[model samples]
Target: MPDPTFAGRTVVVTGAGTGIGRATALAFAGQGATTVVVCGRRKERLEEVAAEHPAIVPVVADVATATGARALADEVRARGEGLDVLVHNAGVFRFSPLAALAPDTVREVLDTNLLGPLLVTGELLPALLARRGNIVLVSSRAGHNPGPGSSVYAASKAGVHSLTRSWAAELAVHGVRVNAVAPGYVRTEAYRANGMTDRQVEGLFDAVAGSVPLGRVADTDDITPWITRLADPAASLVTGQVITVDGGMDTGAGQTDQDA
Candidate 1:
């Protein structure tokens, strides 16, 4: 039977053009979220996903900027419905050595990965509080399990993890639940876009799969269900937790230290 946990609910997923964000948006729609706003910087990609899923409403916005984040929240407000779920999934990861890190790049990464979601959450807090909604921040295992050359990226996600706990505690009185999902390496276009050659990508995937206790790297789909579950009202009592969906990579036996 199709799950109706999200029936009549409105869900917003940032960076839903591709990867886990897209997968999470689709999953919510499939489970009967009446309105699924899929926001991303890539207009074409967002449009394509929206075309494939009638329930998806595409918004081409850069959540990396304060203006863009406010605009997105305004668009959601204009829908005239209280939000039921907000997935802060938009983020960026750059693996530059500390010496090579430019100030602009670091600022951009921090703003996009951390500050943007905080802004959007603030903007939508009213709607979410009215509905006692759920917020799912897509964090990274890198926050706690940082590897070589992941200082800034790890810091950004660590901040997200901290925010998740703080928001969960603060919003609990308002009945708004906050949580995070930290996934290990997942196969996505990000690898290619980040300048990894196809052969290198494959090699990295192989290495990751070998290292993971599950003996495989995850795809976007593999990570979506957990996110959806957290957003579901059925998990109303669950909050202030960071659920690691890394296929046992966090265990001492396996350590897949790649961005999800």
Candidate 2:
């Protein structure tokens, strides 16, 4: 049986259809959270997850827009008295060289990755404040260490990290804690769907692993538990921290050797 640490709490996880988001929703549900609001753009996938766990409340909404965020907040307010945990996990990654990057593409990436979380957090702030809740923003190792083709994605995540610190300070007075988790490359279906061949994906993983001291990529399951722990009331004192769950990929020593 799963632990009952979150037996009576209500948690919200955006992008709960797949990858890290799906794993996170399951983790919270397994912990016996009374209401796990799972938001995603895909109705079928969200319903599939919700079906697996009745405690999961699937909400199909594009959280990248202001209207969508307000709708989600309204729905949660209507169902649960208030929200105790908000996981802003919806994000998109795109690859483009600096010279070839289009203005529209950058805007789209920023809107989805950075502004989406801001809007969602803003809409839910009142409820979260009332409950002294916690917010976990899923950033990426790319934020701290940028590569050649992911300029926009890196910028967006860096914004998330900054927001995490800023909000943690801003909300501390209300007893709300905010933090970010930066994950390295994790195996997800999205990569394959995006036209990455198996060999290419494996090669990318191998390259990333070689750069990390731990020499491996993280699994979605591996990161979910830490997120759950951070959201717990026991971690009340931990805020404004960017916890890099990236297998030491962001450490300068390994990259320094590579560059040398």
Candidate 3:
């Protein structure tokens, strides 16, 4: 049976063009959310996802700017008085060693992964508070484990994790829940498109799987249901928590030792 926990909720999922964002938007629609606003820079992809799910609304905007965030807020306000869930899933990633990383790339990553959410969340805070809503930040295990060539991405997500905690505390009295989902090596098209050679990708996955107790990379579908659950009112008391859905990669034996 489909969960009806979100029957009357309206969810906003940024980065809904593809990957985890697409999966999460679909999941919320399947759970009967009244409205699912899918935001992304690509209007075509966002509209495609919306077409697949009639319940979803496509909002094509570069959420990396304050003006874009305000426009999204205005759009949502036009539909209703407030929103019940805000999923800050819009993000970008690039692989570059510290020496090879361009300043623009670092700034872009930080803007999209960190400041973009801050802008959107700030604009939507009043509405969320009015509805006693929930906020879910899509973070990464990179935040917890800073590896070589991921300094900027890791730092950006680490900032997100910190924001999750701070927002949880700040929004608590107002009854708005703030939490984060830290995903480990999930099999997304974006990951596949990374510059790694096939052998390198396979080796990375193999090493990750072997280290994780579950011994597998996560599928996009595998992570969406949890996101839906957290957005539900049933998770009313859950706040300020960064739940890692990393196939035990963040926890199992040798995980800490290997990284150290």
lDDT of 3 at 181: 90
Compared with the true structure, what per-residue lDDT tens digits does model 2 show for residues 102-212? Answer: 998898889989999989998998889888989999998788877777889889998999999999999999999998888877877656754779888787777767877
Task: Report the C-alpha lDDT of model 1 over 160-214, residue by residue, as the tens digit.
Answer: 9999999999999999999999988888877787699989989989987888898
How does each model score on lDDT? Answer: 0.88, 0.85, 0.85
Question: Residue 128 in candidate 2 has what lDDT?
Answer: 92
What lDDT score goes with residue 17 in model 3?
84
- On lDDT, who's better, 1 or 3? 1
Q: What residue runs in model 1 are displaced by over 4 Å at the alpha carbon? A: 255-260
Per-candidate alpha-carbon RMSD to the true structure? 1.3, 2.4, 2.4
Residue-level lDDT for 246 in candidate 1: 87
TM-score of each: 0.96, 0.94, 0.92
Candidate 3 stretches greater than 4 Å from native = 192-203, 252-260
Worst 10 residues of 3 by lDDT: 251-260
As a whole number from 0 to 100, the lDDT of residue 4 in candidate 1 is 85
Measured on C-alpha atoms, candidate 1 has an lDDT of 0.88
